[model samples]
Target: MTWLIVALVLVVAAAGLLRWRRPAWYWLTFGVTLAALRVLVRYGSVMDACGLTVPAPRWRLTLARMTNRPVPGPRAPRILRFRVTRTGLVLRLKLRPGQDAFDVAASCDRLRHSFAMYGVTSRELRSGVVELRMTGYDVLKRVQMPALAETRPMRVPVALREDGAVHYRDYRAVPHGLVIGATESGKSVYQRNLVAALAPQRVALVGIDCKQGVELFPLARRFSALADNPDTAAELLDALVSHMQDVYQLIRAEQRITADVPDAEIAADIWDLPENLRPVPIVVLVDEVAELALFATKDDEKRRDRIITALARLAQLGRAAGIYLEICGQRFGSELGKGITMLRAQLTGRTAHRVNDEASANMAFGDIAPDAVLAAISIPTDTPGVAITGDSAGGWARIRAPHTTLRQAVNVCNRHADLTPDLPALAPFRPALGTLAPVPAPAVESAPAAA
Candidate 1:
């Protein structure tokens, strides 16, 4: 008994220390309390009183009242499992008959209040199963993601979803995406995470930064091509379009519609082509797209149109050509002029960080989920990396990228500089690495009296 008491005291001391050092561990120490909440959900009148359950029949209520017994009610959703994660507790619930997942989702706010948990969110897992994520504390207050070692071709884990899952960008699945946020709103940080994640991968990096290359210039070593001004951005994008067309021609030549080639083996995309013949995948990162869109004169107008059209074409057909786009900007609206909306529609994946206006959030998620607009704008200014991310399917989640500094990302790119591929078509527009860091003047030696 004395040993057991000592052990309990040690456990409490350790938990308190962990809470002080890492709040994430503090929330995890409440596993027993989370499990007990399931009983409260099963027997308490909170679920029924809140209209979470179906209404009971009058006859059944009357009979129970006559006998001084509790009224019979519909079967409550069964808690099937508990997954304890660094963020919080995940409860898998099996819905009772005639119950819909939306019913639970709509009552999420009430569920948070009744359970006395910090936050609650729900998502339909399968036909009859729903996952209830009860966050004991706000995970976004401090973002820390587990290191990912697995490397899949053309995919990288970029952020952590609210449900304690890693959010990955699979070029083959989503193809193109748009990131919107104001300056210092974690947009740059998120981009750094992406570049760092992809630095060591066997893919080509191209950049279009029109802000005098302040953003992407530090990572010049890893970029196969880069453009730092409006005029240069226009030419680089046009060149990418030409390269995309050449790849399409290659695919056309490799395609064979014959019985000998299995239907699954037929070449429709770069992935379908034989491994030996496939070109390196390219990811074009556009920093501050507005710099590429806004025009000052007639000459600038023509350049803007060319750039926008090239971007639209890339978003439309670049997926099959082993090309993907990561377009980031402060704002994206029709006000940017022609082709902005069209380009947005083609970018199925949308991520909105703390923006200066609701309109910016709407531009990123209005067509997908209007609620996400509210969520995006609600992000506090203090939180740099919090964002609302979603796809065209109308599903959305809160995500945050682990803090990655500019120097860290630059180091990764420099470490993998040798991996940068050389494409003959892009050679002319390749980034000027020699100028990234100014070369020191050569030391002079006296000519030794003309000897």
Candidate 2:
């Protein structure tokens, strides 16, 4: 008994130390098991207290009385499986006859508190099965991104999801995305992480930083084209539109519809074409879209219209032409301009960081997911990078990007500088990074040319 007590004391001490010094380690060693046990033990009582249990069947009571035995307790959802994950416990439950998934979802908060878990969320797997993901701790409090494997091209792991999964910025799946956040909202750092993730891939990057290239110029080595002002941005968008049209023309010409040609070999978009003929895809990052949207004079208005029209066109038609848009701004309301709302409608993916107001949150997730707006607005200012990410599919999750500095991103950009594809359409606006402090111009010039 004395030996067991001493071992328990040692375990407690280790748990305390690890909880303070290394949360992830503590979670793996002690937190997961203890949380799982607590959840299993308290499952029935917690469900009953939270009104998630159905009343005992009258037949059971009648049988118990006839047998002169105690009546069975109310029926709680049957736990089909209880599994331990790195972050928490996942419980798969089979609903009782009178219960449904909604009952469990609505009682998640009570269940979370009863189980002493940090977070609880539920999703119905089928008509009768619901999965409860109960996080043992606040996963987003301290961001630690796991090493990413070889993901699909144009797909980059940008942040950690609340459920301990990687939140990927998949350009192919989302196509065009809108990111909204106020000043000091960690939006810039998120963008930096995204840039770093994409630098190693064989994709063309284009930046339109109307803030005189303050945000994107530092990592210009990986960019095929960059525009720092409204005028240049307008010209750049026109060039992109032209390039997209050129790609479509190429696809049309490549549609060699011979009877012998396999349907899979027939070209439609750039991906469908022969690998040798397929052009490098483009990922356009717009820093501070409001800078390009706000206009005071008629000339500025005309330029803004042209930019918006071009962006709308790309968002609508660029998916087939191997072009994607990542537009970031503080606010993206209809007040920005007439075509602004239409352009926003084309962006299927929406990510909102810590915004200054609920209105800004609404602009991002309003029509898509109303609950996400609340989550976006409620983002504590103390937690900088935490944001809500959702798509047109109407699902949203909280995510926080690892803090990445400008210098780190610049290094990745310079290391993969050779991968920058030279598109003839964007050559005129290509940013000259010769003067950047980190990389030498001669080394950049010495790299082998792209085909």
For model 1, the stretches where C-alpha displacement exceeds 4 angstroms are 1-17, 29-46, 54-73, 148-151, 435-451
Q: Per-residue alpha-carbon lDDT of model 1 for 31-145, expressed as tens digits? A: 4365456535543466675565665567878999999998787556777997676666777888866789999899888877777666788999999899888776666777777
lDDT of 1 at 173: 88
RMSD of each: 6.0, 7.4
Q: Model 1 Cα RMSD, Å?
A: 6.0
Q: Give the range of the ten consecutive residues with the poorest summed lDDT in model 2.
A: 436-445
Q: Which parts of model 2 have CA positions greater than 4 angstroms off? A: 1-7, 54-74, 96-98, 148-150, 256-266, 435-451
lDDT tens per residue, model 2, 306-367: 99999999999999999999999999998897988889999999999999888999999999
Best by lDDT: 2
**Candidate 1 Cα deviation (angstroms), residue 290:** 0.9
**Model 2 scores what on Cα lDDT?**
0.90
